[model samples]
Target chain A: MKKLYTLIKNDLKLIVRDKTLLSFLLLPPVLIIAFKFLTPILVETAPILEEYRVIIGMFASIQTAIMFGFVTSFLILDEKDENVMNVIRILPISGFYFILYRLLFATVFSSIAAYAMITLSDIAHPGNLEAILLAILYGMTAPTISLAISTYAKNKVEGMAYFKGIDLLLMLPIASFFVGSSLSMVFSILPTYWVFHFYETSYNDAPAFEFFAVGFCFFGILISLLLFQFRKRVFGR
Target chain B: MIHTKDLYFKYPGAAQNTVNGISFDVGAGEIFGLLGPSGSGKSTTQKVLFKLLSGYQGSAQIKGKEITDWGKELYSQIGVGFELPNHYLKLTALENLAFFQSFYDEGLDPMELLKMVGLEKDADKKVGEFSKGMKMRLNFVRSFAHNPEILFLDEPTSGLDPSNSRILKDIILDLKNQGKTILITTHHMEDAEELCDQVAFLSEGEIKKLDSPENLKLEYGKRTLEVRTYGSNEPVIFDLDQLKDDKSFLELVQSGEIKTIHSKEANLNDIFIATTAKK
Candidate 1:
């Protein structure tokens, strides 16, 4: 626990020092604030848009999760660029645990941010337990995308390209609502689709228990596969 | 303190083994050098010992346990200094040490370690701003920050000037005095000659010669001595074994007319070249 604390403290220091990463760290809050203010204005300007607040809220929350994942991915890439990963592999705590801690930290931070964004935006009024579960389910996207970017990208430049491409794809699940029923079912393969569906069901006064179960299974399988790939590629384990 | 016997390893999809059937032992309180040019498997051998590489065939032991048998705890027992300087460029020198030091249960003071490497003044300066030599100094000192019993140092003086090189060598020797076992991989023949008690000359993943520097020099050196008389600019060579019976050489020495006499000993560079060239 002490070692994990030390790692977290060091990462916090690194994030605070790097301006680019600091901006990413600050982006989620800015996004939440922007959504909080902009939603009411849009509701006032076009009362018809009031019914689409859930869609608007989905953009902020999901984007916030993606942003957190990218932040952690950039940190991993920085460690690689600096060749500190080699030094880290020889440490008593080992590189595997260090990365595990990063992924978990990103997941937890994104969950809290998602909760804040959803509740503060006043777009979704689910009970506390339901809201927390939905936010936590959405949060799994953090580690999934984090591992995906860091696993495939060899450097920060490549990481940015992957981040942008994955960012656009993550938002694609929302497009399922505009498509035919059969086409909508096709989006279920994407882990984010279940997250989006779960949020949609919960906010619309329906039990999202089924979406939560499916999302957990989808994220679990994808994350496990990515973790294996990450270990093989980065640590060569 | 460390032992390897017929150890072999091949990289994935490689044509041949990078470390092929090499073996050696390093006793406690001794500095053993693996001297070779680049691509000669010096670093690969070090990696196998430190558990960075796996699927290696044959046996390697650290402190009486097989390297494969040991887990991450093995890292706590050994320190590694890589050939290249690897540090958090944005972090201060002190921060880098402090961060690495936090990995161990107990570690030496970061400031004292910085002082040891003459990096105390630059402790607050970010590593990206450091010169190559300064980073190399920090790399060398960081290996033993946790006070490991064994050290693996790869090109410890690679980027340093002569003064700094000498300082690092002195510290290595000091570590030897303190009963620490050190394995160094360097292409610097001068370092091998001065610091190593025993050196293995590696050529294409094979040990061409393994012996003390003095013994190798003696074995490969000329079996004669050169004497220069004060009056003559020309020096005369005499067989070393017959020095006692050479009355003229003795007379020259007795008359104080001998300007200098030196045994024709082969230097480590000559020995390395001659040994490796054989392959």
Candidate 2:
């Protein structure tokens, strides 16, 4: 417990010192404020946007989660750039445990940020239970981004390029809402599609449990695979 | 406290072993040096001993237990100072020490460690702003901040000025007096001569020669002496074995006319070159 506290505290200091990461601390409140004011204006302007307010709300929350994921991934890239992991490998704490702790920290932060974005936006008007489930699913996005960046990118320059590509993939789930259910299944291979499917089914009063189960399984498998690649490439395990 | 027998290590997919059939023991309170040029397996041997690299086909023990049998607890008893200084560059020196200190149950005070390395005044300053020598000094002391029983230092004095190097060497001697075994890998012959109780001249992943500094000099040095008397521009050379039977040599010494008398003993640089040179 003491070791974990120390590690987290050290990470916090690094975050505060980094200008790029410091901006992420304000990202949630800034985006939330922007969404709060802009949603009603968009509805007033198009009136067709009224039908897509829930999707807009969902986009806002997922975007917040993705941004938090970027924060954590950049933190990891900073450590890799400085070769801090090599020093940590010799310590009593295992490198896997340290990474687990970072993911957990990011998950909690992203979950809370997503929940705040969802509840404050007035567009996604979800029930308490649905909101909790969506928040949990959104939280998983943080670690997925962290693992993907660590596995594929060697430094921050490459991380930025890889992250832009990943951002395009994360948005693929939005295409499912426009297409039919049978056609939407084509996007099921992506983990984010299932997350959006769970939200869509619950909002439409359809069976949501299967989507939740499939979403979690995909999240589990993708996270596991990414973790494996991350361990092998980053630590040479 | 450390022992290895016929240790051999070959990297995965490599053609040959990097550490090949080498054996040595480092007792408690002793300093052992693995001296070699690049690619001589000095770092590889240290990695195998520290459990960083596995799949060795020989017996290796640390503190009387097989290295493979030990867990992460082994790290608490053994500290490693890498050849490159690895620190959280954005964090202050004090914070860096405190963060690493949290990994162990007990560690020396961060302030004291910084003071020992002459970085106390810069404790609050970020490491990224430090000079290479300052970072190297900090890297040297960080190895034993946990007060480990054994220390592995690679190029500990590399990149330091003479004054700083002397300070680090003095601290190492102090640690030795406190009964901690130290293993150092360096290319600097002066470091090997001044710090090591025993040194192994490693070349191409093999131990070519191993002995004390004095003994190596005796075994490989010239068996003669040179004498220069005042008023004579030319020096005279005599066989060291027959110096006592040479009247002229004795007469110059007895008459107090000898300006300088020097024995031709090999230094570690000459010995290192001679031993590691391809036969």
Candidate 3:
């Protein structure tokens, strides 16, 4: 338990010191705020812009999810490149504990970012508590999927390559929403798809709770298994 | 205590074993040095002992039990410092130490460790800003922070200045005196000569010679003496064996004509080079 706390604390210190984290966590929130205020002025003069709120909201959620995914992937890749895993492996702590810390950190950071984005946009005004909780749940899943992909990555460059490839595949489900298709069944298989579905349904008049619960349970198990397999292969017991 | 018998390790796709079927024992509180050149399997030996690499072919034991039988509990008693300094570059030196110190049950004081390594003033500086020597010193302190019973240090003094190197040597000696078993791997003959109780010369994944520095030197050194004398305005060399019982040799020595007289005893470097070169 102490070792896990140390690892998590160390990671948090580094994350706080990183300039990139600022750009990653703050930039999207700032952009959403800018778009929120700018849309009113532009839409008053141009009637075509008034009907694009839902599209903008979807775009915002997708953008937020991708940013979250990139941040989680890059963080794991950085640690791997620095041989931090090797250092951690020599410690008396279990692999499960080390991974749990990382997952928790990523989830908390992602949740904060999600809440900030929603609060800034002011379009989907779910109460602060519901928004925070839903974001936390969704945020936790991103890092698991990203970390699982990182297992096959040998270095940062390769990890980024795989991350981008996976991002494209994941974006397919989000893209389904823009096309006005009800493809929750297909999106159910992709963890990010459920995250997007959860966000869209929570604020708008849609069935998000049922989809969120089912998607959370399903991906939760799958990702846990994938994380275990990864931990075994990369850091043998 | 460490014991290995017919231990073998080969990296995947390698043609020959990186570590051949070699056997050795390191007793408690012993300073065992693995002396070898690059790619001579010294580091590989240390890695195996530290459980960094697995899938070996033979038996290895630590603390009177097989390595395969040991659990995470074994790590609490062991510490490793790699050839290269492994630290978070963005973190201050203090933060780095504090982070690793938290991994162990009993840890040395980070401030005292930094002071011992002569990095006390730079504790707040980021490790990325440190020079190679500074980084090496910090690496030395990191190994001792856990107060481990067994220490595996690879090239511990590779990049330090003389004074800092001496400090590190003193710390290693101090640890040894405290009854800690230390395994040090280095190509520096002087380190083995000055610090190790027993040194092993490794080449091509095999130990060429293993013994105390004094014993190895005595065993391999020449028994003859070399006498240098000024004769007719020129220096002349006389072999001790050639004048063993000669009256003229005594007369020469008594007349003070000899400029210098010294036995030809091999140093640790000579023995190391000769032994490893042969293999």
Candidate 4:
């Protein structure tokens, strides 16, 4: 536990000191704040269609999760390129703890980022505590999955390319709503589909237990893929 | 403290083995050096001993147990200083040491170690701000922070100036006096001669020669004595075995005309070039 704390503390210190990464993390929150003020004006000037406000809220939360995942990937790639992971591998501490710690941090950061975006955006707030908690849970998987897939990238440049590419695709689910039901089957495979669907359906009203269950089901798949890919790519076993 | 038998290793998908058949032993409380030019399997041998690389064909044991069997617990018993400086750049020197020290259940005082390496004044300085020599000094001292039974140092004095290099060698000797076993890898023959009890000269993944520096010199050096006379600028050379009986040798000694006499024993650098034949 002490070793784990040290790893997290040092990692956070390194992240804070990294100007590029600090900016990467700051961007999502900045976008959320932008939407917070912009949403009222957006709502006032736009058509009677209130659904775009929900899109803005989901955009902020989802983008926060995605950007933060990119942040985590950047640090991981740095550690790998610097051979810090190999240095730590020789320690009495298991290297698994490093990966495990990142996983937990991603979950925690995503939840916090999600809550701030939803509540501060003030447009698509979950009506109840359960839904709020569920929204946070949904927020956890995007970055987790994103960082997992990012393990394939050899360095930060490649990681950025991967992030920008995948993040652009994550927008597919948001656009799928506009394109109507015809494209739902093609977009449904993405984790962000459930991410967008969760907020779109539950903005003002409390979602059913089954709705939360489906979100968890998608999270389970993402978490599985994450573990399997991490084991294959970064672990090289 | 370390034993390897016909060890062989190949990188993934490489055409040939980076570490070919080689074997040697180092006793407890001894400083053993693996000396070679770059890419001569020096670093590979060190890595095998430290358990950083795997998939070897032969056996390697450290402190009497097979390296493969030692697991993570073995790390606490040994410390490694890689040739490359691997500190977290943004962290202060003290912070880097303290953070890594926490990984071990037992530790020496990091500040004391920093002080030993003359880094105490710069403890609060970020590693990124450190000069290469300062970083090298910090790297050398960090391996001792855990007080491990064995130390693996790969080119511990690389990039260090002569004064700092001498200082580091002094501390390394001090660690030896404390009964710590060390495996050092370097192409620096002077360091090997100064510090190593036994050294292996490696060439292209093979052990070309292995012995103490003195013994290797004795075997390869000319068995002659050079006597310099005051009047003549040139020195006269005599076979060592004939020195006592030869009238000229004794006459020069008694005549007080001899400026200097030196046994023609080879230095480590000369022996290294001859043994490895690496330019």
Tens digit of lDDT per residue, candidate 3, span B1-279?
988888898977799999888788899999999997788888887777778788888988888888778777778878888788778888999998888778677988899999998899999999989998998888888877988889999999998888988999999999999999999998788988999999988889888888999899878877766677777555445555777786777887899888877777788889878988852
Docking band of candidate 2: medium
lDDT of each: 0.90, 0.88, 0.76, 0.81
Instruction: Give the candidate number with the greatest DockQ.
Output: 1
What would you estimate as the lDDT of candidate 2? 0.88
Show the colliding residue pairs in model 3. Answer: none
Error of 3 at B247 (Å): 3.8
lDDT of 3 at A194: 67
Candidate 1 residue lDDT tens string, A11-63: 99888889988999899899888888888888999999888777887788888
The true-versus-predicted C-alpha distance at residue A227 of model 2, in Å, is 1.8
The residue-by-residue lDDT of candidate 1 on B38-123, one tens digit each, is 89999999999999899999999999999989988999999999988999888899999998998888788899988888899999
Which structure is stronger by DockQ: 1 or 2?
A: 1
lDDT of 1 at B4: 95
Q: Which structure among the candidates has the greatest lDDT?
A: 1
* Model 3, span A120-237: residue lDDT tens: 7765555565577566655655666566666778886787688778757656666757564655465656766666666667667665677667667766787778787777667764
Better of 1 and 4 by TM-score: 1
Please give the ranking of all candidate structures by DockQ, highest first, separated by commas. Answer: 1, 2, 4, 3
* Candidate 3: Cα lDDT at A173: 68
Q: Tell me model 1's lDDT, rounded to 2 decimals.
A: 0.90
- Candidate 2 versus the native: TM-score? 0.94
Docking class for candidate 1: medium
